[model samples]
Target: MNSSSSQIDVTLTVKDSLLGDGNTGGGRYNYTFDPDLIHVTEHDTEIVYRLAKEDQPRFRIVNLYSTDTRDQLDELEIREDGAELKIVHRNTYQQLTVVSLLVHDTKHDHPVNCDPQVTNDPPPVGP
Candidate 1:
């Protein structure tokens, strides 16, 4: 499979209001791409969410689901570190689809930068 052909683009944005109150805040993130352009089952991809250094311990994931079906994708496994959130998918029969993620935090009074990166791993070598 061609790795470049299965690349997916993700967009993440935080509202200014989230930076005004330290109480509770949330943001919506979306992932989208042309279904015809990528063959999901043939590629393995990971979505990495990295938080700004200072915001590492402040923010947390509230809920994440598919916008189209409003249901979580069972194929995804989430891993979190002090500053990074990683979502991994090895092989899925489902098509590469759109998804929405919600992140909530208590230390939102300060600007919290979140960067998302998508990496498609090459399939395992065969005999």
Candidate 2:
């Protein structure tokens, strides 16, 4: 068997907006893909956020999706402008807000539904 090269992983995380799961307010969904060889089917309220392994924006909400709450990444898009290096995301189910910013993953940001609050203090180290 042989492996493949030149692939990019698109991690899609979806969550339900209503019917709070009692203890939790929402549910999560996830999908992974390499857009170079596949078609991405986006819902009417979903959007895409592309980041480096270190959480830097490589591409933002360029090809914005329109579903209630979904995310997808697809194809190699050639840039005619110098804007792909910025951060982009949908603050809502509609419209986009691109920023030169970085966001820590919130419960709302995870398909696993974990909106946790953390202190800046790093974990205790051995003395």
Candidate 3:
């Protein structure tokens, strides 16, 4: 039987950051998906990642982090307008799981040209 029940928030967003990881002493490092980058304080360090079509439900990674840390590590706030990632500590990844932050890539800002038709090998010659 389909019964209607009260809807509760199963997952939390970046806006609810203050309430995140109180005991962990830190919060999830928030990331946004939009026109990026805005320098914060001089000491603050910023890292950027481009989430391709494959990287979806981006929040899942953060949730996995929370569970793995046993809630000791808190989540940081990530907003579209936010260009900086703030942390109470040096902001090292401890058991954090995410790939391709694009730190070393110098040409990251430019859109990637994905040509399906381009083949590395030439066509075979007919007999």
Which candidate tops TM-score? Answer: 1
Superposition TM-score, candidate 1 onto the true structure:
0.41
Q: What tens-digit string does per-residue lDDT give for candidate 2 at 1-127? A: 0112222234322234354542222332322222312211222112223333422222222333222232222232423231222212212232222211122234344323222111111122124
Per-residue lDDT tens digits of candidate 1, residues 1-127?
A: 2344333433333334434442223332222222323233334454444444444466554444553332223444344643444454454333344544445555543333332222222345234
TM-score against truth, every candidate:
0.41, 0.19, 0.18
**Model 1: worst 10 consecutive residues (lDDT sum):** 27-36
By lDDT: ranked, best first: 1, 2, 3
Q: Candidate 3's residue-wise lDDT over 37-87, tens digit each?
A: 221211112222223332323322211111223222233444332222222
Model 1 / residue 75 / CA error / Å:
4.7
Model 3 ranges with Cα > 4 A deviation = 1-42, 57-59, 63-75, 79-127
In model 2, which runs have C-alpha deviations exceeding 4 angstroms? 1-3, 22-127
Positional deviation of residue 28's Cα in model 2 after best superposition, in angstroms: 8.0
